[model samples]
Each structure stands twice: as C-alpha cells, then as structure tokens.
Target: MADQPPIPFHRGHFLFGSTFSLLRDSLGLLRQLQQQYGDQRVVRIKVGRRMITVLLKPEETKYVLQENNRNYGRGRSYKILREFLGDGLLTTDGDYWRRQRRLAQPAFHRQKLALLADTMIDEAVSWTSQLQRLDKTQPVDMSAALMEATLRIVTKTLFGSGLGDQTTRLSQALNDLNHIISQTVLNPLRLPNWVPTPANKSYINASGLVTDLITGIIRERRQSTGKHDDLLDMLLRATDEETGEGMTDAQLLSELVTLFTAGHETTAASMSWTLYLMATHPDVQARARAEALRTLGTRTRFSADDLRAMPYLTQIVNESLRLYPPAWAMSRLSLGPDQLGAYHLNADEGVLISPYLLHHDPASWPNPDQFDPNRFAPDRSADRHSYAFLPFGGGPRLCIGNQFALMEMVALLGQLLVTFELQPITSEPMLPRPLITLRSKQPIRLYLRDWPV
Candidate 1:
C-alpha cells in the first residue's frame, strides 16, 4: 500500500491549512491551484482535518465519473442534501439511485418534453410581457425575476396548470431553503440543526411549508380522475420493468421536491448568467436577437422546432454554461483504493472535480476567460474532449433534464430578446457565488427597453 508514489500537496498554513482560503474564495483558490499545479499531476489540499485531491484534467474527471465510477461515490455534502431534499436521485446512489433514475428518465425524454414546449414558451412570453410593464426607469433584479419565471414554468410543467397559485409560496420557501442550505454548507462554524438556532428554526419552517404544499398537491392529484399529462402524471403512472413496482408516496414527495427545486434553479441561473453576458456583449446579443427574429418572425408563440433552428443561439447557451455552469463542482468519495491517471487514491478519500476549472484551462480553451460563443461552433468544438465542458456533468449521472433545460433557456432567451433590448445597469461583471447552485453574489440588475419593431 505504501509503495505507490505520493500525490503532490499544496502548501498552506500548518494549522488551519487551506481552510481560510477555501472559505473565503473557493472558486479563486481552485483556479490558483490549477495554475500552480498543471494538468499532468493531481493536487492535494487539506481543509480543516479533511483532505481532498483535486482532479485537474478531463481524463481524470472522466475516469472518476464514468469508466471506473463504481470505485467512487457521492461525497459527504450529499448527506446535507438528503437531509433537506430527501432520498431523491440527486442524493441517493447505488441501485436505489438507478431505479429512481430509470423511472424519472422517461419523463424528460425529448418526445415527452415536446408536450410541454408551449407551456415553457407561454410562460416566458407572459413573463416578458410583465417585465415590459415595469417602470423602465428602474433597474429590474433579473436574478430574482428569472427565478420567479422559471419557477412558474417548472410548477406548471411539473404539476400541470393546477399549481399556478402555489408558485409564489413555493418560490419564497425555496429561496429561504437555498439560503439556509448555503449557509450550512459554507459556514464551518454552523451549528447543528437540533441546536434550535434561528436559522435552524427558519429551515424547519420552510421545509414544513414545502412538504405540506407538495403533499397536498399530490393528494389532490391522486383523488382526481382527470389526466393532466404533466411530469407528476407520468411519475404517478410510471412502473419499474423488473420489479413491476411504483414509487411510494414518500418517494413521490422526494422526487417532486428535487424536480421542483433543481428543475427551475439551474435553468434560472443559466438564463440569468446568459442574459448578463448578452447585455455586456452587444454584438453577440445583436447576433442572437437577429437569429431569433429571423426564425420566430411575427409569431407570439413558437414550437420546439423553432428552438431547434437557432444554431447560434444554442452556441451562446453552451458557451455560457461552460463559463458559469450551475453545478460548478462535483465531489466524490472513493469507495476503495483506486488509481486516477498516475496517482493512487486511498479508500474513503475525497475527490473534487471542478467544471469551472476544467472550462477555464488555457490548454483546452485558449484565452479561456473571453466571452466567445463561437468557440462552441461545430468546426471549433469538433476535437474537444467530452468531459472538458460538462455543465450538466458526465457519464451515467449526467443531469436527466439537460435537454429540457437547454430547450427552456433557448425558448426564454428567444422570447425575451425579440421583445426587449437588455441593458446592463453597471459595467461590473457579476461574480459567481457557489451555493445550492452557482449563483451571482449580487442581484443582476438590468434595464430593458423595447426592441425596435
């Protein structure tokens, strides 16, 4: 066991080690580590008493997440997720995760997703109209607005139109939950949930509100005889092929919470960031709006096919995802001794994969910090590694809703751009803050004027 060569370690304070830097600016620290230690070797660092080996290359990420995935499982943070989100696919692993994934997979298929296209576009158009009515003199908090809009779409698409009134309540509760979860994860000094802290009490109240609302919705659906043809309907009707079984009520609750939270949050972040980029890069925004105007000419409503026709718009979405992926970092704990590229990992050691770092690697992406959506064009991306730009992750655990997210982003962006000219209120770039998802540390304020007819 001791014969294997030791992994390289980053020098830090002897006592706290790299804990302060990690707590202060993990994103910056990760980028610094990648620069100090090139892609050829794995870099190890200690935070508090725990040790994590950072994977810098695409091959290493692919190995841990795909080829030899069985040797590595989700890390400890997932337990915090399970505590809040229940045993949904995002938290559970092994056979249970597989079963959940299979049952939920069918709901997100392109064919099934097509059924909800109108709902998505309609929501975006409706939200756009609402934004148009706002006083143009004041800057709108785009981050908040996008979250609200995506929440509306997710609720309608998930539970059919019946939950329209619940969106506001759900959105508020989810916002509180996100803040609580972020504090718990990032604050090393956070107290235990059982300690009766004010934050803990708030978390409990928010969790209860969400649980009750969802439970009541599910209850009403089970009692109703009519079919709604939404995700919930499909989930309720889903049956496991092997076991000939279905998800229990508790299982349904967990999955609904997961989809409702994950479904909207990530897409909202992507849209917010993309719009920020578009506001800052007028040429790119003009090009994208031109593409949208051409394809969606004089139409108040467009089909999924219309979204498929915008290649340049799709490129913009992909590049934004590369720069600011919602799931910026993934963690896994080795189940046993394993070798990742040239380094050997001990059992129970933590492995960290940062998509943010991979996307910014100058070796893979020349002048990586620039906002060039053309980098995603077919000719340029032809030879790129599959794992190098994983915004939704890679391998079997890839986000089930990736296609759905892309379609929604394209729909929302297309709808909004055709109607409004996005103007950034400030020149400062929005900083990324790692939370339940990668989010802007501050609200993205934008002033939108009607696009010239």
Candidate 2:
C-alpha cells in the first residue's frame, strides 16, 4: 500500500509558551489559527509539550459528530469528568453509553420537563429578587448570580425539597471542582485517583458530599408515600422498556452528577452570556423584552406553556448559544481507519469539532462577529444547513438536556428582563475561556438598573 501524505502541521510561536499560557489562551490561539488557515485546517496545538491535532471545519464537524459517531469515542478530554462522573452518559462510549442513555432518557421526557417549568421559574425569580436587593450604587457580578440561579433550578428539579443550605455548599464545591478539572487538563501527568494532592483531595471530598446528598434524596423519596414527580423520582422509577432493568444506585448517582454538572454549568454560561450580550446590545435587548411582555402580559412568573408561546425569546437564546456554545468543542477518537475529506483518519487519533469555529464562520454567517438575533428567524434559519448551528450538537449523542436547557433559558430570561434592566459595568469584551464549558475569563459585571415599572 502507498504511504499517505503527512497532514499539514503549523508550528508557531505560541507553541513554545508555558503550559498555563497555552491553557488560558487557548481560545485566542484558536482564533489566530482560524484567521491564518481558515476553517478546517489541521494544526498542531501544544499542551505541555504534547502536540494534539486540532480540526476546525463544519464538514469535518458533521463527519465527527454525526456520520461516524460510532467509529469515534470521547477522547482524553473527558478523563477529568470520569473521575467525578464515573463513566456517566457524557464520558462513556459504546454499549455502556447506549444503556445509560436508555435508562436516563425518560427523566428528561418533554412532558416531565414541562412539569419542571415552575421549578425553573421559581428559582429564577428567587435569584432575581436577590439581585434586585443589591444597591444600585454597586456593580453586581451577573455571571456568578446566573450560575447560582441555574444551579438552584437544576438541583431542585433533580432532588426536590430540603436543599436550601445544602445547595450553597454544593454550589461552591462544584465551582472549585470545575476549576480543578480545568487546571488538571493542562498538566498531563498520569496520577492515581487516590494520590491526594490538595486539589485532588478537594475533588474527592466534594464528590463524596455530593454523592451522599444525592443518595439521601433518593432514599427519602423512596421512603415517602407522597408523590413528587420530579426528575429524581422519575429516574428512580424508570424501568427499561426492553429488558425491564432499572438503573442501579451507583449508575443513578453517576448520572445525577453528570446532569447536575453538565446541565447546570452550560445553561448558566449561556444565560450569563445572553445577559451580557443584552447589556451591550440594547437594541436587541429591547426586542427580546418586548417579545416577553407581549407573550407573558406583565406576569412576574412564566410557565413552560408561556415559554412555548414566546418565539422571539427562543430565537434570542438560540442566537446567544450560537455565539457562545457552552460546550464549545467536542473531541472523539477514531475507532478505525476512515476517510475525512481528503485526509485519512487513523485509529486512536483524536478528532475535534469546535462549534465555536463553525458558528462563527463568515461563510455560514454574515458579519459573523456581530450580535444579531435575527439570524435565527424562521426565514433565515431555513436557508442554512441543519448542522450549521449545533449548540447542543447533532446526531444521536446530542445533549439529552437540550430541551431542558432551552426551557430553563427561556424561563429565566423572561423573569430577568421583566425585573431588572441590565447595563454593562465595563466595556471590555467578554472573552471565552474554553474549559469544561466556555466561560468568561472574568465575571460578567453588570449594573442592575431598576425597571421603571
């Protein structure tokens, strides 16, 4: 057999930077590559002296995410997740992932999620009320506030009552855990799980506390005669239609952790970015507010049904997601040799599909860098390819919580707009730091201008 031509590799100045610099400035580096090579260039990125191939194109993204999904499995990027999530849906591949997906699918059923609307709205309103109490003289970190709000909603929806004080501790622990995971990704030394470095120890302790909380919730729900139709209850009662097998306690715990982590963080970041965008782009904000008022009619609270009725609000959220997909890039390892474009992919070689690059491609989107919610209008969206806007990704392995996240955003946005007028505290651009999810490097500082109403 003839030897295949070597894939073009670009070695640049940034490749020699410190490991922390490479980790912290990853998005900037990616942007530079996009400019130099255009989308779909295979560049060699250095992470602590290790060179990893980075693929950035929509066609390649579709090939990796949809067409050859089974041939690829979640790669090294998810190793940090497996420690805490324990081979849950997001980190697992092959038959294990398939089985877990089947077991957890019913909990996120549309009808069940519809019931969660009130929980989402209540949490949003509660958080907004706290924000409103802040003195207008001071700036509020809307980023942190949004994170807390989304965390509360997901926690409540998953575990039901008695989480008031526990939620605060859990949120702080999770935040710390997220930071540790991001740091660990940059340092590639293989360390035993029980090594007990300060960061690792913290993660272990946090994981234990969270697991205990989830187990207690499950036990309490099982013992109670009162019916709570929330997700945890649904997960507990869910039986596989094919084999009638139920998820074991450990399986359920792992999934609960996955949902709490993946579900809340991404939704929080999306909503935070949406608010930041709204603060900076007042005109678009006005349109979103007008849409909410027209559909909701001065109501302080919105329901799932009301969210469904607000189409423009949905578009605004969709547009925000396109600009800053929470899960900005996804990675997979080819199980066998395959053809991707003109390049022949090899087994065990990693492939990455960055939604960040695809959604911002100038060809797919005009004035790609600009904030334009109108791009998501029915007429405009109809002209685009289906894979062009993959905030929750495409194909079977698409985020199971996609609908739930959308609902949470709509409910939260509806309440936020009606309660406080958001103003940017600083004009600095909210730069992306692509860790577990894409997050702003600094807190999204904003002034909570009181609504005249």
Predicted structure 2: lDDT: 0.80
Clashing pairs in 1: none
lDDT of 2 by residue, 4-113 (tens): 65555565556464345456576666667667666445654555555555666666667777887888888787877787888788889988889888988988888888
lDDT by residue for model 1 (1-453), tens: 478668889968888778889878989998999899975558998876789999998988899999998888888778788887899888888999999998888888889999988889889889998998999889999999999989889988999974667667778888889888876765657678899988999999899888898899899999999988799999999989889898998999999998888988888988999999999999999999999989988776778799889999999999999899898887899999998777788999988999999999888899999999999999999999988899989889998888989999999999988888999998877899988788999988899987776
In order of appearance, the predictions have TM-scores of 0.97, 0.93
TM-score between candidate 2 and the true structure: 0.93
- In candidate 2, stretches whose alpha carbon ends up further than 4 angstroms from where it belongs are 1-4, 13-21, 39-41, 44-51, 298-300
- Give, for candidate 2, the lowest lDDT window spanning 10 residues: 13-22
Clash pairs (backbone) in predicted model 2? 40-56
The clash count of every prediction, one per candidate, is 0, 1
lDDT (C-alpha) at residue 27 in model 1? 92
